[model samples]
Target: MPVTLAIAGLLFATGSNSARTDVDGGRQEELSGLVSQENRKVDAYDQQVERMQREVDRASRARARNDKVAARAQERSDELGRTVGLGPATGTGVRVTLDDAPRTEIGEGNIPPDYLVVHQQDVQAVVNAMWAGGATAVQVMDQRLISTSAVRCVGNTLLLNGRVYSPPFAVTAVGPTDRIAGSLEREPGIRVYKQYVKTYGLGYEVERLTEVTVPGYRGTLDLQFAESGR
Candidate 1:
């Protein structure tokens, strides 16, 4: 009779545990669904914000153009004041170049494979440092910089302002060269990069340019936002 009771007890315990696990799993599924729904709502809100900003920019530009035309027609003196001579300008700033480090021999496990390659974050860090050092304008490659532009990397190529570029990226900033250069030198990640430059032939340079002109941002600003129903 004692043995029979033991078997019955074991069966009851096993069944109870199985029921509890099923209940917990169902609750987890419900919670996951709620989180996903919340994320969707947040993403929608961000899209709306970007759309509104574009609309504002477009309206501002239109008003400025109309004002210019009216002033040119009605007031000769005002038009003359608005017109300024376009002249060659020069700025003294620093140029920084970043390239992939040289590959190491695979015989020893001394170095990881990722160590020899350049990353997008590395480029971003340098650019951020320059901006923090009071850079007025910054340019990457042949394209001019803009406030809305984003720099991204896929594999070894960089994507900036709807253009693709290969490595050995050059970033130029118009600012106080001394302060910009100092910022780069003082960054923590740069120390690791210096090691790469010494171990492998990573291309790096900081040169002060006598003249550089960063053009203004040129792109269409279109706005799209969620209407009441849509």
Candidate 2:
């Protein structure tokens, strides 16, 4: 009877120990599952943070590029203006004027009505002549003439550098007086216009200015598109 009771007690102790070990294993599994879930959440949060940082970095670079472009454009415009005497002045030069010949009669079957007025090409010829004569700077009317500016005429109105003005046009240039005078006399087109000057009494004059000051170029520079490598 004692031996049987001892065997029964040993079996009971073994069963209790086995049950405790199973409980501990279950608790360990639950803890492992929780740790894996937390790790996954942390990984997801880190990915989101990394993506946000990349977007911020790209935006910053784009803004920096735009600012650089703007600065460059401003510098170019400023330099061009200064070259054309559109800025503060310190020089000597010559001033020339050209105007439409006075109307003698409204004739029929001669030259067109538009031909009576000075053409844009006529002013362009004078400006070109000045440039060829080694003009360092030139200004037309109140606008400073630059390398990029175009002088165009539609009907009798003059379009210069995207602006419109009526004649009695005045062109000023900083250069040697003798060279400028020779340029005017030597231009083939000007000679042709001089015929009109005599026939139509068109206004024309070349005056050597002792100290002439021209104005600076005033215009906007907005660059919306550019090649990547340029």
Candidate 3:
């Protein structure tokens, strides 16, 4: 069941992966171009949001007509921003990093080739468990998760949102460090992956952090479509 959760399927998936790089030649170039474009768009959106927030702060400070009201409004806005991962977050937490095993003969006895490398589900397993454990926010690779975020695999690389990242995938969470670690240990899916960790040396590491910061999500929040509940 743990392994099952890790490999859960959904729509919009691409080809599965082995240890080999999936993006190659023209295809790689095309994906690179798209990733670059998406990164720029995310940057632009972050800048615009920052600009608007600064303006709002200035306006709020200048208006003395309702000082208390303005302060409360700004407080609520900031709280909601953090809740939605739109505000930078720093706190005590745990960091779990996963990497593909070295290409070697160790643990190659009966394990399949596919188990040697990290998959989207492996990363997703750790992430989903941390959240279930009360993670305030989580960062995968270099991007913070939003409700609409998706994790997929195109070969051995991770396609998150619109970016491609190679492991070791570092998943950091801001919350009670003990609870986070315990959650990963108790998560059936993560436990299944950990079995491979012992068998094939697939990377699964945990470090407790007294202070770590997860940046606010920078991608567009607008939904492109939604399934009809027919």
Error of 2 at 199 (Å): 1.5
> Model 1: per-residue lDDT, tens digit, 123-215?
887788788777767777755555555677655556554344567899988788888888998876777787877876677888888778765
Q: How many residue pairs clash in each candidate?
A: 0, 3, 2
Candidate 1 colliding pairs, count: 0
**Candidate 1 — what's its lDDT?**
0.62
What's the candidate order when arranged by decreasing TM-score? 3, 2, 1
Taking the tens digit of each residue's C-alpha lDDT, what string does model 3 give over 61-99? 676346877777778876887778988888999899999
| Candidate number of the best lDDT | 3
Model 2's TM-score against the true structure: 0.57
State how far residue 216 of model 3 sits from its true place (Å): 1.6
Name the best candidate (by TM-score): 3
Score every model by TM-score: 0.55, 0.57, 0.70
lDDT of each: 0.62, 0.67, 0.75
lDDT of the structure predicted as candidate 3: 0.75
- Give the clashing pairs for model 3: 2-188, 2-189
